[model samples]
Target: MSEYEFSSDAALLDGDWVHRTLREHAYWAHDRSREVQDAANAGSRCFGVYERGTGRQVAFARVVTDGATFGWLADVIVDPERRGLGLGKLLVEGIVEELDALGLRRTLLMTRDAHTLYGRHGWEPAAPVGDWLVRWRH
Candidate 1:
């Protein structure tokens, strides 16, 4: 209902927002602050959507890639209250743009329950998934 803006600057990710995103990812990140700081320090690609006036981050996504031919999406989260408001789609689109910029020919990601959401963005289950053995997903 309010103005929405998206940015790729980690500077936009404040402590409170970083904490919330990390808490939401507690399952995968044993130490959230470390992850946030690492991402910042590594110059990793990250996306955040914020409320207009407050600049409060409400959605976030990041990618790990070699800036070449492959891209992996990680840490994509939309604030529960902000879910279904198109932030996720926007974030993924941003990631796609990043991949294009990197000259990547293909991108890969795994989502437990967001197949449909990712499908809306043209991502579908890869056939012959047998190629990559299921190890551990975190």
Candidate 2:
């Protein structure tokens, strides 16, 4: 049996777990407000990874897509207590499968530290550092 399982059922996601992980642990969303987080959850395709025996969520990822040709994978994080067991891989692989099923030609993500993990799953730097520009609002 697999040690972990992935589910795209957003209903299965524990909002408290997700909020705390992002707010307290994940660098990317450490200052993100709960209201914004809830809104994001409402808008994206969310995936969660759980331990097989306990069904406790240990990792999460979300994709914003146009349902046709493009997607952006974001907010991927693994619970610190559960890192290094390949749950991140399982989570990303599950998301990729779902995105592929949607027939998206390109999916993108930005990470300061997970390039190797994403690379193992077929993600590469998007045209080198300065080649891409992002305009942030707020």
Candidate 3:
């Protein structure tokens, strides 16, 4: 068993923690505003990884989906202090499993780095069709 609990419950998410982490560390969301993050969460399927004992969110990710054919994953971040414990892999794996259950035609995400992490979860560069099929098989 892992030390973290993964959840898709928006209610369990810590928006302030997410906002601050992304604002300070994430290259893509460094300048993103709270309003935008809130709105994004409101419209997307949000996922978080929490410390099992304290229920404190330690990681976050969200996917903008139509609940059918497509999903666009965004804002994937793990608390810097907790990075090497495999929390990121756990989070992304959970998200992929959730999406796979939806049976969506495609799920997409973009990253400037961390290719190795995503790749381990079956994500690939460009040509989303292959990536979708690859992830679906797992």
Best by TM-score: 2
RMSD of candidate 1 to the true fold? 2.9
Better of 1 and 2 by lDDT: 2
Model 1 residue 10 CA deviation (Å) reads 2.3
Choose 1 or 3, whichever is better by lDDT: 3
Q: Give per-residue CA lDDT, model 3, range 1-138, as digits (tens).
A: 377899998999898999999999899888889999999999999999999899999999999999989999999999999988999989998999999999998777889888999888777877644554543421
RMSD of every prediction: 2.9, 1.6, 6.2
Off by over 4 Å in 3: 128-138
TM-score of 1: 0.79
Cα displacement (Å) at residue 48, model 3 = 0.3
Question: What overall lDDT goes with each candidate model?
Answer: 0.73, 0.89, 0.90
TM-score against native, each model: 0.79, 0.92, 0.88
Best first by lDDT, ranked: 3, 2, 1
